[model samples]
Target: MSATTGAVLLYDGDCGFCTKSVAWLDQRNLLGFPARPWQSVPDHELPASPEALMTEVVLTRPGRRPLGGADAIAACVRESPSRLRFAGRLLALPGLRGLARAVYRLVARNRYRLPGSTAACRIERPG
Candidate 1:
């Protein structure tokens, strides 16, 4: 994909689960998409609140639109020509979309309780 088509994955830098997820994505070599931690995204540049970011995974597609939570994951899948991409498409279908979104929300809300999360993801307040 051209650099302009590249997607930016904004994740929680402090969460072990998030880190592991990023590592997994990296290993797949799924088009080698670049990822940036939410903490790394300059505060002045983000359109949404830091709290919003802490609550969802954000994916920004240059020259395109941004995706969050389940949509973001689907975007990642759609970017690659793999079985997962097909699965993502299936999940986007009407019947499955609700379930998929629900599951993503549940996991996102309880990420800290999951195996790799060290603590609940939180956004730092400006002093």
Candidate 2:
């Protein structure tokens, strides 16, 4: 995540996949997007319940409404520098946006099984 001001990206700190993903993006310096774990963010900083945040990554800008998951990523990429800006454009293309959302959901749902993730990353199904 970006360390500079402007937009913020919030992720699950306890999840290995989430943390690693954040770190990966952080190192890339994606247009100064401030990334932090929701666990450390103040309640007043969030637009919704922590549980809701836990379910998906969130992107928030000062005046705009908070966006979640793939939409959040798309918004962030759109604001990123030229090199990575193409990703945001791709997300906006017709038909691709829905595909991106579907892919994001699939990966999010199965993140626990991915490498680097631990049991803590597993989201249990509701009984």
Candidate 3:
């Protein structure tokens, strides 16, 4: 696939939890797309503002709107090996989509407390 059509996963490099998660995906070869730390990605390649990016993972592909949070996770799964595609579809289903997003938000908000996470994983909440 062309670079524009290929999916790219952008995540927070400074967060230990985030780094570990990406490493897990890489170890399993479960991510079909290239993953990059948001800090290392040039501004022009980013689909959203830096502040927004810090709040959640983002999946970007040209000619389409960027997918954030749980949606990005679903998209990554769908792009993974055939065996895991079903789970990805399930996550994106209308009925489960909202729940998945909520869970993702919850986990994101408390990432600093999760295993492998460090103080840098603490996200600043907006007022």
Select the stronger candidate by TM-score from 1 and 2. Answer: 2
Q: Which whole-number lDDT from 0 to 100 does residue 121 have in model 2?
A: 87
- Say which prediction, candidate 1 or candidate 3, comes out ahead on TM-score: 3
Candidate 2 per-residue C-alpha lDDT over 1-127 given as tens digits, one digit per residue, 9 for 90 to 100:
3312357888888899988887877678553467788887777767668888777898877778888998888777777764887888799787999999999999899999988797778887788
lDDT of 1 by residue, 9-61 (tens): 77778788877877786677542347777787678766357788777778777
**Residues 30-98, model 3: lDDT tens digits:** 676788888887777678888888889998887889899999988888888857677778999998999
CA shift of 117, model 1, Å: 1.0
- Each candidate's lDDT (Cα)? 0.71, 0.80, 0.85
Ranking by TM-score: 3, 2, 1
Task: Return the lDDT, model 1, position 13.
Answer: 80
- Whose lDDT is higher: candidate 2's or candidate 3's? 3
lDDT of 3: 0.85
Q: Is candidate 1 or candidate 3 better by lDDT?
A: 3
Best by lDDT: 3
RMSD to native, candidate 3: 2.2
Off by over 4 Å in 2: 1-6
Model 1 off-target regions past 4 Å?
1-6, 30-32, 120-127
